[model samples]
Target: MDLFLSAAFGFPTVLFTPMLIVVLGYWIFVIVGAADTEMLDSVDTGGDAAGLSAVLSKAGLGRVPVTVALTMLICVAWFVSMMGSIVTSLIETVSTPMLWALGAVVLLIALVAAWAVTSGVVMGFQRFLPKRRGDSKHELVGRTCLIRIGEAHEDFGQAEITTAGGAAISIPVRTTGGEVLSVGSTALIFDHDAADDHFLVTAFDPALDPGQH
Candidate 1:
């Protein structure tokens, strides 16, 4: 204990060790979080079906909120402890060996704690994210929606469709075969083109489809 206290009270390394760990670990998390990996390719982001499977697969962080909070807490604590250690060391009159021992013990504890937190976050993310099911765009092909804005020509337009949960989405749409869809007219999502970021639609009267043929 004497050796530990003396080392901690004399060496500058002890004061900055925790701060280094925290900063370094945080950058690691950021890189993992933002990377678009192959594992995320299977998840879907279509309307209500969007979930965390893609996010976690790419970043390896369980829940976004938990990962963010834990990282921030670790960083804050590290810097705070680092500053505190420096002040305490300056005021102390301890022996060199003792201070060194204390610094070693503190660094070990901080390192272990940081590792545990990182592992926990990774595990949590893997466990909570759901497995991908299937493509939903295929099902939208025959569904009807209303033109919320301008006409849907071969090039550009917008429309609104109520999704499975009744949530509405204003998405870019186009006429499947150059048919013009006027405002408030009913249209069907005939095709979805990811590259163009728009849906190929067709004008259709629901009442006519129902009876008049």
Candidate 2:
């Protein structure tokens, strides 16, 4: 047990100890229902969450939450730390500065590798995971939505909708006619755009659209 502790707290592996601890503690919090509300709301298409997700969405990780992304990073760091320790252990003797330098380089490489692996997993999840309850995307067509971003264009935009569970969800949206939709605008999701993979929205007025009710 002492040997195991020494190895874990030793040079290279020690670098990732902090991250591993965080990951474990985070899960514990989630299990006990003490998870952060901020994380749950990150998947929202509006507000600052959208900006952060825009970069991740470009990287194919938009579906993944920030907490999950962070967890991935920590998991990869722990794995890399263990690998580094093994490699360094094979060496006879090394100077303190050299070890630190090696750890720094490993940190850079680990971060890149972690991002790749995390994004890959997130992409995979999008293909198989349940997106909206048990309903398929096709079933969501014709639903009404509220624009949640500054302006929703054919190119970029987001909207909020209420689910059968009475939970509000934010999702990507686009105009069917390439029109611009301002924040808080009401729209009817007429169809799904296959090319862009988002809902095609049309201007809707509760007073004018009889189908709104």
Candidate 3:
């Protein structure tokens, strides 16, 4: 109550107040189903997926999604600012120049810490996430599956198909030529696009894909 307000609205840490608000707002949207993790991975700056991945890898944030990186950054900002407040408060008469220098150092530390945290978190979750087996994906080629996400774009999306064991496997998917499949739509995976590491899914038609019929 009082402590939260003090930390959030007080000096130094108050700089991250807006960031906290934004992060919280994003999670709220995610909870209510207005948004999803795909938004974080879909920011394109006129580069292909491989180029974007390369840039992210060079930045030490390749494994972490953009939203996860941003969330970790905001958390680090709040932590560093609060730490600065605690340390600065102990000083009897700190000058403005000295305070600025300390702030700069704290910001640098925050940046490094945020990157480390993001990497660590992504690695930690990797053990629990399912990996697509090369052999299995090859067999799924030309199989029809249901699109589970909001929309399956040519770049990134997900599809769901049930297995013999009654377990539903969700696989990352993509298409080409500006094709986008809405949620609940059926698609026939034509080929395994190895370059993009996703199944090249096409709209399913009864007459077209006799294998499915």
Candidate 4:
């Protein structure tokens, strides 16, 4: 028990311990319905998350949700580091500095091994996961959505739309002609802005909906 605690709190393994805790907490929240599994699905192009996403994509781990990939990565890293630390503790003759150096080496190996293992697992299960349909973007056009953010204007907005599968998804939206689309207001997705990766919307009246008649 002492050795297990020591390894978990020791140098290299300690680096990943907090991450593992966070991953565990996130999953707990997911299981309780307090968080969404796809909460981190969207990556801001200019942020650090985007860089990490690019790296994961290059490593073939991008097909899965970022949350899933990161959870697997941290779990694998923590386990490997813990094992390495346990093995290092068995070497009694090593000086403090030498042990630190060895821990650093273990950390590096753990990271690489985690990525490799995650990539292989992701590839093996990719076919079983729901594939994102490219045509869905075009299909969203002409759909009615509810504004989910503050007032939507030419520059910024967000809305929620339900798909044929009954899953609600939030999407980036933009308005033209200075329309007043506020939270809870209905909007029509008239067109898709492929260049900006958002939907072009206009204010909608629920009474005007043909289905209401």
Candidate 5:
């Protein structure tokens, strides 16, 4: 064991002790947290929780939250090594040149490990995040819809439609005064009501075309 340690790190066993401890602790924390989030996606929660995930979603971490956390942990490790009396005691008494080289090597390894762990976690979770919801303003134009609820007469109503491929759609409905629709009535989609975020619809009947008798 001693010969292997010396050959690998070019240092005595004692010198490699701290590096192994820090690396082990870092891997345990990051891997366990990642596994926990992966399990949570299976159960439906009211969307309330706080932890590493909350940190990832803040305007800053869109692509990789784990990477941010790993970077932070590595920085903390370096600061602790430099400032903590115990860490200073362990490495400071050693030869200055050897200590400096070891510190540089350890810090580099920590950074690379952090980056790899972060990239893996982010790639794994990207697929599980819920996709953006709700129809866009442009898509509501010219599509047929049904009155789901509410009246459409110089006022407001709710409706649902399906795209030609059967994907469900939702839109708000309204009509000129004195017009109203009940459940299951078909309406022509015409315009969008920006103020209410609803769709303006007109009664559409296929039998009564302008060119037909």
Candidate 6:
């Protein structure tokens, strides 16, 4: 127990200990709904996080959420560093300077190993994760949807549409010419506003549907 504690709190392992603690705390907050998994996703576009994002992208770890990638990285690095520290601690008659040098090498190796392992793990799991893409957005342009919100106006609205795959999803909607669509009302999605990422909708009349004729 004493040796484990000494190795954990010692150099190299010490560098990743704080990061591991932070990752654990953040996950606890996420489990309690106090934080979101995507909270750090937008941080990759700008600020200091951009540099980190670039590095992860280069490492093929960009497909996963920043928090997830970071958590895996810190966890793997901490474990590797802890093991390295324990191994080095077992070495007797090593001068203080030599131990420090060995710790530095361990830190570097830990980082590389973490990246390699995390990248493989991410690739293996990424296929099972839901993909965020607009490939099907165009298919919804001419579909009819039921208004899910109380009212859909020119500025704001939401409606539920079923895809060809039988999956239902809620999408932002808008009306033109001061059209008002209320809940339980059916609306036709005639166009998609790419700039605002919303669908243009108007009230639907079942009798007017060409498919019925």
Q: Against the true structure, whose TM-score is highest?
A: 4
Overall local distance difference test of candidate 6: 0.81
> All models: lDDT?
0.58, 0.69, 0.68, 0.82, 0.52, 0.81
- Candidate 6: segments with Cα more than 4 A from true spot: 43-54, 133-213
How far residue 92's Cα lies from its native spot in candidate 4, in Å, is 2.1
Ranking by lDDT: 4, 6, 2, 3, 1, 5
Per-residue CA lDDT of model 2 for 1-213, tens digit only, reads 565565468765677787789779988998899885235323232223344445665666656565666677678867776666656655666688877777677667766777888877877778775442223467668778899968998788889886443346777888856699889989888887777678888888867766555
Instruction: Summarize candidate 6's per-residue lDDT along 19-114 as a digit string, tens digits.
Output: 999999999999999987755543210112244455676678877767889999999999999999999998885598999998999999999999
Measured by TM-score, how close is model 1 to the native structure? 0.38
**Alpha-carbon TM-score of each model against the true structure:** 0.38, 0.51, 0.53, 0.71, 0.34, 0.60
Better of 1 and 2 by TM-score: 2
In candidate 2, residue 90 scores what lDDT? 58
Clashes by residue pair, model 2: none
Candidate 5 per-residue lDDT, tens place, 33-112, comes to 73222321111111222244444444233443343444544544433333332333355456878666666665555445
RMSD of 2: 8.4
Model 4: lDDT equals 0.82
- Give per-residue lDDT, candidate 5, residue 210: 50
lDDT of 3 by residue, 78-180 (tens): 8877776666655666697876677666667766776677677767886675541122567677678889978998777789865322235677888889999
- lDDT digits (tens) for residues 1-213 of candidate 4: 999999999989999999999999999999999988766654341212244555677788878777899999999999999999999899986588899899999999999999989998999998898863222787888989999969888989988876543456678999988876889999999999888899999989989989678
- Give residue 171's error in model 1 in angstroms: 1.3
Residue range with the least summed lDDT across 10 consecutive positions in model 1: 36-45
Positional deviation of residue 81's Cα in model 6 after best superposition, in angstroms? 0.4
Check candidate 1 and list the clashing pairs.
3-98, 4-102, 6-98, 6-99, 7-98, 7-99, 7-100, 8-99, 62-125
Which pairs in model 5 have colliding backbones? Answer: 172-199
Count clashes in each candidate, considering only residues at least 3 apart in sequence or on different chains. 9, 0, 0, 0, 1, 0
